[model samples]
Target: MELFEGRPADCSGRQEREVRVYDLLDRLGIAYQRTDHVPAGTMEDCDRIDAVLEVTICKNLFLCNRQKTAFYLLMMPGNKAFRTKDLAAQLGVARLSFGTPEDMLRLLDVTPGSVSVMGLMNDRDNQVQLVIDRDVLKGERIGCHPCLNTSSLRFATSDLLEKVLPAMGHSPILVNL
Candidate 1:
C-alpha cells in the first residue's frame, strides 16, 4: 500500500464513517498520514500496513464489564498480551471481556476489526472509556484505523492525547500491562 497524506482525494468508495474520521481530524488541525489497504482483521494482517505506515498499528480492543454496563476502548502494542486480571486491578473493575459487535456498533459505531481510539468521537454519551498502554503512549507516533480496517492512519501521539482526546471529551486512563 502506498502512504498518502491526509484523506483520500477521491472518496468515491470510502465509507461515511471513514470520511468522518478525516473530517474530524482535519477540523481539529491534527496532522496525519494515511494508507489504504485490505480489511485487516488480525494483527498478522496489519503487519503489512504497519510496515508501509512506518508505525505499529495499536491493537484496539472494545471491551465491557460482565454486566455490560461499563465499556472501554483499549490501545496497546500489537505484540503485547492482554491480561484481564492485570487490567482489572488497575481499573478497579471486577472483570472485562471482549464486547459484543452489537454493543460495539451501538456505542462506538464501529465493528470488530475497526475498533479504534478514533471511534471515541462517536461516543458522545461517554459510555466508553479510553485506556492506553504506557508503551503506546511513549511512542512518538501511533497508527489506527479510521473506524474501518480497509485503511489506516498515523499521527503524532501528542496530537491524539492533547487534541483529539480532549476534543472528544475523553480522559484516557493509562495502564501498564
Candidate 2:
C-alpha cells in the first residue's frame, strides 16, 4: 500500500483497504496531504502523529446502542474524553458500548485499529450512523486513517461532507460534546 508520504506509491500493486480509499479520493477529485506514521489509537499515539502532521487526529469509535439495533461511528477530538452517560443522554439511547470487533467487521468491513469514517462505504445497508464532534468540524482540514491504521490522510472537511459522504450514501450527524 502507499505509505501516505508526499509521493503516491504504486497503488496498483496493492489491494488493501488503504489503496481503495486513495482510489476513491482520486476519483472524487479531492486533494489531500498524506503522511505515514506508526499505528495510533490513543491520545499519546495521536500526540506523536499530531507533531508530525500538524493536525489533531480524531478518535473514531464504533459503538452500538443497548439493543444493538443502532450502530454509530463517532468521530471526535482525540484529546477529548468519552463520556458514555453524556452521549447516551444526547442520543436518547438507553446505553451505548463499543461494538465487538466481529460486529465492526460485519457491519463496516473494518478491523479494530483501522476503524474510520471511510468504512461507512461498506455499510450499503445504512446500518451505521455517523456522529461528528463539534470541535472536529471547526478545522478546515480533517485527518483520518485511510481504512488502515498505518497511515493517515488529510483533506478538506468540506470535501468530505459535500462529496465523499454523499457519494457513500451517508450524512454525518454533528453533535456537541
Name the best candidate (by TM-score). Answer: 1
Q: Candidate 1 on 1-177: residue-level lDDT in tens?
A: 899889889898888999999999999998899988888976677999999989999989898899999999999999999999999899999999999999999999999889999899999999999999999988899999999999999999999988999999999999999
What TM-score does each of the candidates earn? 0.98, 0.91
- Quote the positional error of residue 171 for candidate 1 in Å: 0.6
lDDT of 2 by residue, 1-177 (tens): 222443266665443767778878888999887877667766677777776667787889999998899999999998789998888788888899999999999988889988999898889999999999889989988888888776787888899899999989998888888
Evaluate model 1: give its lDDT: 0.92
Query: Poorest 10 consecutive residues of model 2 by lDDT?
Result: 1-10
Instruction: Report the lDDT of model 2 for residue 9.
Output: 61
